[model samples]
Target: MTTLSQSGGRRLIDLVPHIVLIVGVLIFAFPIYVTLIGSTWDSATIGRGNLPLTPGGEALVNYGQAWSESHGARASYTPVRVMLLNSLVMALTIALGKIAISIISAYAVAFFRFPFRMAFFWMIFITLMLPVEVRIIPTYKVVADLGLIDSYAGLTIPLIASATATLLFRQFFLTIPDELVEAAKIDGAGALRFFVDVVLPLSKTNIAALFVILFIYGWNQYLWPLLITNSADMETIVIGITKMIGTGEAANDWNLIMATTVLAMLPPIAVVVLMQRWFVKGLVDSEK
Candidate 1:
């Protein structure tokens, strides 16, 4: 009887974890499933409430109307394609910019001997504590002074300096052996050549990982974009979706909004899926 009770107790413990994980997954997935299904229906069907679990036949039409907002005069916001393009540009530019700047900054701090180097690094690190919310006013003023508002530069440039990625790269660089530095020196590889050949290749996994993360960060930016962009053309997908719902409007186009949401989720999902291996390795694998 003791043996039977012990076995049952262990099984319950094991079963509990699995049950918890399954419940968590379902909680996250259910809303996504409902959104996908709702995207296929017409606005009236969704407006009526009690949305059906099954997908409707208006998938193509709904997607088309969402994608091409020029279909009619009733478009409440910028077209999804235009917003998508803006978001893609912002995400890619921010990701690349952050990675480039962070990697170079890390490489310099890790490899070079400069006065006040650690101080500079610490300053950058400290900025992480001063999030965008704290500095948005000054940032906006800077961008406004530079006349970058409503431009791609305004959308991405201010958001690109990433202290977290810089820290990660610095930590990874520190893990690299002194042997590689000597080896590169012996090969008569100048700083530029050594950095191009050695450091860049070794940091690929980290770069890929940060790129995916930074891309999503840029893609989801709302407050900065909202503050900077006054024109419809500069609207991002995140903001565009919000604009579509409007202020207490009873005639909200739920179908197009759902469709837009699904569309908005695709790029981040694709980035994660495509570079999944590198991302995982960058996070977990401990090779210099």
Candidate 2:
């Protein structure tokens, strides 16, 4: 009876946090739910605050109009589609480049001990403390000098190296056993072969987690892209979305705006959901 009571008490303790978390999740998600529902209505109805709990007739019509007019009032270009593609290309390029560079850099740092090793690592770590906003001016100048402004290189090249990814991979690599490295070396495996066959195989989870993080970061980039990209063809999804909201004299089309917002969010949401298993596994492995 005492053991049974103890088990029950333990179960209750575990349940308490989950219950609280679910309530908190609901609180946060309610607004997004409202926005999604609001997207299905006509702008006038949304402006009038007559948004229904359930979506009605206005969803398809507003979505169609939003898709059609996303470029501008003149409707010369489809801004949404262009911006979507730009964001995807930029995000994927950055994610892949960062991962490639970080994996190599991190493996070197984690596995090799050379002169001024700690100093080099510390210098790299220091970059993490400097905000990207602080470096924007110099970055812009460099991009302008290289004629990368208003080009894909301007959007993707500067962000190819990520301090966070390097640090995350370094931590994970440090946790791996030295015996494995020694064994690989004894088997005539060079550094490249060891890294490719041993380290990378073990780092699948970490790589997946990093990919998701960097992808989201690149996708949500607005200020930098806005600063660099002069052409409408070069604008990202986030920048396009902000421009969709009109100024004071102009009437804002809330329905179309909300619909575009919803569509813009779908990719990141899908990415996270699809990779959730790997994300969770990465967290577990990191803990181990």
Candidate 3:
């Protein structure tokens, strides 16, 4: 009886964690669930606060309308399709740019011994303390002065150089065996050839991880994109979604807003799901 009781107690204790985890997941996911359900209902139903748990009949209509064109109750009449494309371009550009710049920055610092290299690296690192909020005005002014305002260059260029990615890549590069470096050098491979062959292949997981993170970062950008682009077609999906809501007696098309929100979520979700393995390995695994 005592042994049986102890076993049962252990099982109960184990079950407690699973129960807590399930509850936590439900708590986080509930808002998404509500948004999803609300997207299917009409504006009148939502405005009347009839937030049904089950999806309603207006799913197709809401999504179709959101996809093709804005309700224009709040913001521009630009189609969500154009906004989505803009967002995709911005996100891809930022991700690829950050990766390209960071990897090269890290490679130079890690492999080459130069005057004040560490100082330069620390200078790059110091930028981390200065968040976007601190640099926004000057960045905006510079971008405007450079004739890049309302352009893709303004949207992506100011945001691409990432100290964090550089730091991460540098750390990873440091872990590489010295013997490998020596062997590559002995084979008469130039710096570029060695980097292309040896370094990049090993950094694959890390690159994938940073790409996912940077892509999401760019995709969810609100303030910078909002400030940079005019409130027109160049606006990203995030800006578009926010613009869809009405304020102060301007009757909102809640259905369309929710549909846009749902659409906005999909790309990032797809990225995370598809890159789950590489992302996890890059972040957690130390093995080369």
Candidate 4:
């Protein structure tokens, strides 16, 4: 009886984690579920202050209006298609640029001996203590002087070289076996060739995982994009969606606004969900 009771107690302890996880999931998902249901309803229904817990019939209409139609009388109205394209360009550029620069920087720091190497690494690492918000004024001034404001270069370049990504790559590269480097050298591989052939292939999981993270970060950027891009053509979907909501309470189009919000979330969610396996593997392997 004591043995049976102990087994039952162990099972109960295991079950406790699952119960907590289920509750957490429900709490996190409830807002998204409400947003999804609210997106399908009419502005009138939403404006009337009805809580939308069920799907409504205006899904197609709301989506169509949000995507293709313009918000008439709004001076800064941008097409959803244009905003989506801008966001895609910004996100892709930031992700690929950050990964490319970070990997090369990390490879140099990890493998090569040079003066001020640690200094450079520490300099990059120190940036983590200072977020974009803290450096926004200087960053904006540089972009303005470079004639990049309201341009893709302005939106992406200022944010691309990530200290965190550099640190992550450096940590991962240090874990790679020294024997691999010796083998490549004996086989007559130069520095560039060794890196291209040996290191990059081994770093795919890390690259993909970081890409997912950086892409989402770029996509969700609000303050930087808002401050940089004054042109409607360069506005990102995240900013454009907020602009959709009118000033006065009575003037807001909740249905169209919520539809735009849904569109804004899909790309990042899709990237994370699709690359979840690689992301998990990268995190695990990077630690080793």
Candidate with top TM-score is: 3
Candidate 2 lDDT (Cα, 0 to 1): 0.83
lDDT of 4 by residue, 1-288 (tens): 999999999999999999999999999999888889998998778778886698999999888877887773223357778899999999999999999999999999999999999999999999999967899999999999999999999999989999999999898889888888899999999999989998898899999899999999999999999999988889999888777764566667777777888888889989999999998998776443
- Deviation in Å, model 4, residue 146 alpha carbon: 1.3
CA-only RMSD, every prediction? 1.6, 3.1, 1.5, 1.9
lDDT of 2 by residue, 1-288 (tens): 999999999999999999999999999998889879888877667778767889867788767766655443322334466778999999999999999999899998998889988788888899999999999999999999999999999999998988888888898888888888789989999998999898888989888988888899999998889899988889888987787674332466777677778888988999899999997788776443
Q: Which ranges of candidate 2 are over 4 A from the true structure?
A: 1-19, 71-78, 286-288
Segments in model 1 whose C-alpha atoms lie over 4 Å from true places: 1-4, 71-75
Candidates 3 and 4 compared: the better one by TM-score is 3
- Write the residue-wise lDDT of candidate 1 on 1-288 in tens digits: 999999999999999999999999999999999999999998778878878999999999989988987432234767899999999999999999999999999999999999999999999999989867999999999999999999999999999888999999999999889999999999999989989999999989889888888999999998998999999898999999888877335757788888999999999999999999999998888766
Query: How much is 245 displaced in model 3, in angstroms?
Result: 1.9
lDDT assessment of candidate 4: 0.88
Clashes of 3: 0
Q: List the global CA lDDT of all models.
A: 0.90, 0.83, 0.91, 0.88
**lDDT tens digits, residue span 235-267, model 3:** 899887676663434567887888889988999
Clashing pairs in 3: none
Q: Which ten residues in a row have the lowest lDDT in candidate 4?
A: 70-79
Give the clashing pairs for model 4. Answer: none
